[model samples]
Target: MIRKELLSKCKEALTTRQSELIKQVQDHFGMKYEFAKETSGELSNYDNHPADTGTELFEREKDLALNEHAEKELEEINEALHAIEEGTYGICKICGADIPNERLVAVPTTDTCVEHAKNETFNRGRPIEEEVFSPNINPDEVTDEEQVGYDAEDAWQEVSRYGTSETPSDFYGDKEHYNDMFPNSDENVGSVEDLENFLAADIHGKFIGVAPNHDKHEE
Candidate 1:
């Protein structure tokens, strides 16, 4: 149970970091307010000009930015701690691999190993952890006429508008097979547009819609 012990230590370290970050946030804000108060008081005297006000502003701004980022890390760490407690901590969100200890030490909130983690690129304003499994679930690749909400009425409408009403019957081959199956009505090149045209027409016929632009034409 070395993983368990490391996980606990990692949680403790993160909690300590969270506490430290909160104190730093408070101290930085206090420093800024105190400086501002002093500057305002001196300005009220009408002749007092601080020599390093610009430098102070620059330093304060940078420190404020850093503290905010640290605070955000604390948020992720808290989430990670909860996940650990819930016994859902080490499983990779993408490939279901056991996350390595080194990675846990480096980024305890992470839910994926390096390989799967590489597939997921995202930006964080602070220390980061990512969960890349949910929206990208199995068959996140399902792209079809049915997925785009297209029915025969829509195909009928497109054919009636651009080509011929008879084209729908000829294009789809028969109405009975596809009257319930629907058609692709993507705003741009649709599923129907791909298999029906292009150099890969024969390939598409053999593979339904695996034409060159199958993904592009996916509704």
Candidate 2:
């Protein structure tokens, strides 16, 4: 059983906090909820530069958010006070277990025990995509039987040569450039082998002269 003296102490703490929050909201953010133009002391927003207006609007929004948070905390304090009056101050609402006096001392506004209060038992659940999708997807590997060679993976690599969502950090090895970020990026694109790119052949399948790959031969 929780000591009556502790309840009295908690009630005192809650009341003090409630008063402080009310004063803070009144003093710091009393006029924060007013119209932007009125708060800014401007005749019209139309005369203000866009950047100036944006900064003022951001400040006003920040003030309102702070006030809202204070008000919400005040509401919790009020509820805790009411629970104290109703003789249910130290009881956990979810499990009907007696909350430890230590927890009550730490957070006077909390009516639930730490376990339930933290929502650890609650099922926050997973995304719907998890039901249909596998966690791992290889950029170069493909499983489609009919795809054969030079399929979707090749097409994606071609497009990724321009740009892709994958960053250099995503690769296991060092990747210095955006074009080098994709998997198997160094592989030949149009030809079966590297030699086939530069080696010319006649229309009759006769061997012709060698032409160096300008961009690749240098490396």
Candidate 3:
């Protein structure tokens, strides 16, 4: 019940923030559009002033990007509001824990915790050197075409003159192995078995079925 109250409060605050941002975006677009159009009109009557037209185009382009980004944010906030209505608000998608109050306050539209945020990923699906820092020389120059390079295996072979053709194991898969070693820390504070007893089969009208961690954390 307390958690639900907190969730509602957080949602309300986010609603307010989103509303404010929406107003700001609308005002910006409205003001910029009028300014650009007025400038263009004034330029059309001028003896010779190409700079005004250029300025208008620049403002339109800049506003276009801002509008796109703001629209995406508005959609995300709407999704978060819808989630709150559907009664699945504060849960982290990655770990299934109740995300911290601070995080919820900071990013109401966020589906993951600060640690699991999309921007904070450490090891992507691809391996280290092979993934991003690919070799094949020509580092002195760059081309605009494809920005990819050869695999780390080839680079290692070329540099060391000794290697096998076997592919390296992928360490970034979403496999469910090695889960038993680390229970959900947020849920299992004391004896894990006792904590398991506290988790409910139904979480605030949300039914996540048959997952081992879900069973472990159900109140």
Which residues of candidate 2, in runs, are more than 4 Å off? Answer: 25-28, 31-33, 118-219
lDDT of 1: 0.60
Q: Tell me model 2's lDDT, rounded to 2 decimals.
A: 0.78
Task: Tell me the TM-score of model 1.
Answer: 0.44
Cα error, residue 117 of model 2, in Å, equals 1.3
Q: Which residue pairs does candidate 1 place in steric collision?
A: none
Candidate 2 lDDT over residue span 194-214, tens digit each: 776676676797877654453
- Which numbered prediction scores highest in lDDT against the true structure? 2
Per TM-score, the best of the predicted structures is 2
lDDT for residue 81 in candidate 1, whole number 0-100: 74
| 32 Cα displacement, candidate 2 (Å) | 7.4
- How high is the CA lDDT of each candidate model? 0.60, 0.78, 0.61
Which wins on TM-score, candidate 2 or candidate 3?
2
User: Worst ten-residue run, lDDT, model 3?
Assistant: 179-188
